[model samples]
Target chain A: MAVEQVAMSSPDERITLTDDQRRRRRSRSIAIAVILAGLVVLFYVITMVKLASTAVDPSL
Target chain B: MAYVNDLNATEPVPGVSLATPRDYFELLKPRVMQLVVFTALVGMVMAPGSIDLFSGAVALFAITIGAGASGALNMWYDADIDRKMARTRLRPVPSGRVAPGEALAFGIVLSVGSVALLGLAANWLAAGLLAFTIFFYAVIYTMWLKRSTPENIVIGGAAGALPPVVGWAVLTGAVGWESLVLFAIIFLWTPPHFWALALLKEEDYRRANVPMLPNVAGAAVTAHRILYYSLILAPVGVVPSFIGLASPVYGVIAAGLGAVLIWKALPILRSAGTDRAAARGMFGYSLVYLFVLFAALLVEGIVARLGWF
Candidate 1:
């Protein structure tokens, strides 16, 4: 079931999202959220690897 | 605002976005990205020395996203021409599923993000190469050459060829001689492969006013050029064996594939631009030739890595 949404397109004007638009927007939002989470994990792991590499190599 | 009917609304509405996650993904030209990732991986595998598994994976990720960013930018810039071509008419920007501004923003974000991530995850050389590749494809090729010149695919092929070099740089932290051989193979392969498609899509390109080789120089010239490149490519494809990057087995296979490519090209040349079937056959085998040739190198790389040599 697609849920319709009420969004403010302007300060004085209200724009309504049709159910399908709302559904697609929700999916897009979810995808973005997931990708952001993946990036966070990637950054964290890469940082740890870099730090560990530096720790093992002291001759800089 | 969504002014369209609420029931079963599949079409995009003005000022309202109906684009799904899939439509956004389509903007990246995933098939092209697949080829990019594959070739870059082959480069990564064949380079001297070894990269840690995690770092290599991350580098590949960066390259993949960078390629996608370029694809998105190309879609945004080429939307008008894309709309005019039947093969590309249904692309996201041309179909109105994704807005041009959205694609541009998506591309820019991914481009920056990928470069930064690559710099952090690997070395700066690979990151720089990825950034340059994106710029060449998006601005140099898509925004400039494609609209202006018939040799667009030829010069633009350089951007596509750089992936392996970038891949090599990722692992070795410097571009290797072996990688240039990889680069040359793809660089030379691009014209024949594209011109063959141009033969079939001559009308589409001409209707769009794009000066593809076939549309500008005529099909006979294009076929002759294809023969010339095919002859050069067959020998170039076997260069990796002498360089010790590929095994003799792979070199033989590359030779066989190159021979098949030439055999396919021979028919096109003999047909004198009148044969669509010959062009199609050439196009189809070209794909197989590159795939198997690369797959063989990948296999040899894996065997060497695993001490199976």
Candidate 2:
């Protein structure tokens, strides 16, 4: 009822979102989160690889 | 289409606006960011030392994000002044499509994240330069100098000019004379490029109370300044060739481009102070001059690497 009331009030105060708009927003948020997580993983992997490459060989 | 309206809404939306992804992207000033990325890439390529593919890619990505962060923060802080300028009135923040607070937060997060990642991926020297660049643009230039001084663009130009140096540092883990030359070219070119626009938009700048050169000094003074900078920039454009950083062919191209830029500025100098057409032509040619100068370097570097020369 509040949403309906706000919708009916005025053009400026009301920001009506269709179901599709909401869905797109949710998807964009998820994509950003996933990308951030991927970057963290990448940094970790690269650091480990660099350290391992510089480590002394035990067999030698 | 389905529509819903609130009849009583009269105030500005308080972070409740439906901003799409594109609005957020626009806040990054993608056009400016593209030039930043291109110039940075040329610097990296022209550097003497070689960088591994993975490291180079990561460094470039970090620099790109850092450039975007500065753009976002600039928009956040300049929203009020931007609203008064015809050229910037339609930007995301001034256009009411994005919340200013959101832009600030986005900028800060990206700024920190990009610098840290760049340090980890490449070296701290490059990261330090990038961090200082963001600070210079956001705080020194945007917050302080822009409103306070007519020479704001001259000082703020340092922020834009440092990308090449940052890129060179990423590759060599140090700064060199070559990178400094690249930085100088852009630094000197900035005044003529921006002041030409200022000449045309003098009224808009006056309305916003921003102390652009044309607003503080008269148009004749601004035109003379543009000519002075352009004359200096023309010779500096060919410095890379003299230093052996670029081939002689690049020297010829740079000289010709610089000549064209001088020719463009001549009209602005000869015309009456109110000549928008001359100012616009100079502004447009300045863009071409910088792009082609860098493009020549990029092409020459590729040719040398391929042994095609």
Candidate 3:
């Protein structure tokens, strides 16, 4: 039997993420990305410096 | 259906006139996704070597998608029980905002899409871990354990705890002791963390026929269990520091926070309260403790890499 669509109001009201919550989450994500990017670049530069200093010394 | 008719005809009405695709998206519990992503990211960071921006973004994206897929699948499986519980009754499927079939389809699609993409962007190992995580949560935890035993959360916590391992695999293409420690930290953290809330909402669990620890074992037993696990968890949480992945500062903070976690569990172990203030306090502090410990690890990791330590 095809049950008729019940007309009862929903017991479960959906809770959407609020604009403020979205903004906070977004900003936090961007901050983490920035920190990660900064770390990568810093690593690259340091590795390059150590390589260059070793090349100049050519001993030990 | 009669249920839908009754819902449409009820008092106070629903806050939204109709649930769109986005509303169904919210039902996937995106907040939980954020925590998973953060822990996974920390695990990736602490792994040996480094990743370029483009590859890192791709890895994080794959992880996020996998997490979202898991959430959708969880909602799909639990839709029936969710409708009966006051806490989960308002979820999209239970509330009639989204059909159950739609959620099932959404989850399936994300699951396939994320795993395939992860395999391409990261490594097969990481992708395999993602696949396993999804199956573990949706099948093992949801379909099997959730209805079977009071030990459900204890055993099922593994699914939730694998993100860091997934994160580590993304870079190294293998699981090592370092990532294992991260996994252990979260694995041990989950039971005490969730049981506190379960204690607070014992009645809700009972109403839904879900055999949470407090409902099955009594509040005193549940509280004592929480204390025992928290004591073990505190020392386990600090193991990474001794292994050279973290600094002394992480050790000190972890010990302090671990002490505080035990302190929070102590009151509840002694007495059950009508208001749930102790459970609430534990729940809140647990969030802060995990966040602080992970953040400390990240800071120390960066400093050590920079030779500032």
- Candidate 1: C-alpha lDDT: 0.90
RMSD of each: 2.7, 4.4, 10.0
Q: In model 3, state the lDDT of residue B118.
A: 74
Report the TM-score of candidate 2, chain B only. 0.95
lDDT of candidate model 2 versus the reference: 0.87
lDDT of 3: 0.79
Regions of candidate 3 where Cα sits further than 4 Å from its true position = A1-60, B1-18, B272-275
The global C-alpha lDDT for each of the candidates, from Candidate 1 onward, is: 0.90, 0.87, 0.79
Candidate 3 residue-wise lDDT at B198: 91
Tens-digit per-residue lDDT, A1-60, candidate 1: 232444445665455775667788899999999999999999999988888888898663
For all the predictions, what are the DockQ values?
Answer: 0.38, 0.18, 0.11
Give one digit per residue, the lDDT tens place, for model 1 in B74-126: 99999998999999999998888898899999999999999998888889999
Better of 1 and 3 by TM-score: 1
Candidate 2's DockQ is 0.18
Model 1 compared with the native: what TM-score? 0.94
- Ranked candidates (DockQ, high to low): 1, 2, 3
